[model samples]
Target: MPTDIAFLAIAEAQQLYHWLPAALELARRPGVRVSVLSPSDQLLALVASYDPQGILRPVRLRRPPSRPDSLFRQPSRLATLLLNYATIARFPTLVTTEISSAWLRRVPGFTSHLILIKHGAGDREGGYKKRHADFDLTLVAGEKDRRRMIDRGLCTPEAIAVGGYAKFELKAPRQRYFYNDDPVLLYNPHFDPALSSWVNHGPAILASLESLTGWNVIIAPHTKLARAAAPIVSHAPHIRVDMGSRHSIDMSYTMSADVYLGDVSSQVYEFLLHPRPCIFLNLDHRDGAGDAFAHWRLGQVIDSADALPQALARATGLQPGFVAAQEAAMQESINLSLVPASQRQADLILNFAQTSHPAKS
Candidate 1:
């Protein structure tokens, strides 16, 4: 007998990278079967690329039907889950990167142990949801999340594992979006209307970028926002706008950028992988002291897009002043270890499965 585990890639494609490595790792071990369930062919194709030997199974889920006249759209998380509830309930253990999967527990006769691998390291309140407590086990990137989740009563210390950042295991070659040696700035805004600076000041910020001399700009908003509208156009030669592309999610911008600009996106933590300059937009003027805005302390938080010029002007000169804080925050936000995060997470899952429900000979 073998333990069965299913990894759900049911959310946005951007989230797949966060948990796929662990799935691949689990598949390699003996006496465990690993399957990846996804509604998108593109996502399944990606899984196949990672598992060239076909050790892991890729199960293409049936998506709910859409209106024939409707434009192409990815199925909503709830819709995907509801449509595939029966298939999902068969597994003894299930792992996913998002919280919506918690809904599966509501299905009649559902008894699978739910595991959550948080996708981002940001300090947004949305990241700490009540539903997190429902998971049998939760995996996070670092102590920052482990502490916060415990403080918020979202999970007990025993139920949570600090698995480092699984997304960091993904390696993408850095791309040069601009030819010159000018500083490249990555403007990655979250898609949440109430929290993202893009919802309010995006166009103004883009317009202002044209006036900034000797700086190359990359406008890569969250994938959700990119899917909502037509691609943004930039007339300025120094500005490169990517609504959402492989480069946006693959760390191409985060790895290559010299300066980071955004509101409440977790990509800032990704950018801090190198401890570069960062300027956050506090356009809505949220409380700086709140736990949700804790990441704001890592950089300059400006209240308006009008300050963009001055911020960029002084970014490099001020970067040295923030290096220590940035490094400390990065360490707190992501636990880097000699062992890859994927391996640690895979090991934890294996231990949990065998102990929770051992297969009888």
Candidate 2:
């Protein structure tokens, strides 16, 4: 029996590193109870270990949709409405990311208010707006993103607040880079072809760097790369493919890197937090394209693999300024002052619970 409000979180194993702590903290609030629906077993195991006290209730989601790319995709409108009805039966308030918010709104008690928590670039697309339109309040990682959201068309324009980088604000620093060591480069490629991929001659760019032993490279491809079951990357003596390392949940590698190499990924924002040199592959150079948010202004965007050599040369040459620019952009994009954005998010959940006035069990 729920005495106050039931908060729901839709999570996965690879995402537990960020969501679990936030879930646990949210559960600690006096009038709030936190429950989770995880799509993977690994996430279940992690929640058990992380919150042995059983503060978090766990639920199983329906079988994942058939399409490989659809795992995180929003469900059909009908499906979303049904899920919302089911949640409404058990909880007074619902708190979730953009994907799950629409469905949860079908729950009767959540009619007057909803809260949307934007996780990454994925949320910035259609996924967030679909559900967030119902939100009485919304949380964003920073001011830049809040403007971006407003431009995208979310409801109640005044409802949005800079939540800071919620994911980073929740975790302990994995490790920090020490100076004078051989710099480590984290090459994180997005899974979208429209953005960056081997189709854009990624191998050629890698081949160009074979002679340079100045840095160790960790190739943390998007998780989808691992789903292929085939070799996502051919071995390189200098390049290590971290197929097993879960960036969806853990970002220590991104946190520690002295340099970042990628196209456009939200991880770039995290990398920018520490201020580092970064290189981008401008496969299509969509900087001025109608979709401006798709363009990441963080680093040098090279159009061809042949140009990588010069980009690397420039990155190493102007390391200080490069790091500063990344850091400055990060500050511009997010509100670092909102330490523990997740906690602030939890407080919003509590406020929703109070407003809803759930009936006694």
TM-score to native of every candidate shown: 0.94, 0.79
lDDT string for model 2 (6-107, tens) is 433344334444345556777776646677754444445556776778888776545345333233232343443354455444554555553554554454
For model 2, the run of ten residues with the poorest summed lDDT: 66-75
Q: lDDT for every model?
A: 0.85, 0.59
Residue pairs of candidate 2 with colliding backbone atoms: none
Candidate No. with top lDDT: 1
Q: How does model 1 fare in lDDT?
A: 0.85
lDDT, candidate 2, at 95: 55
lDDT of 2 at 266: 70
Candidate of highest TM-score: 1
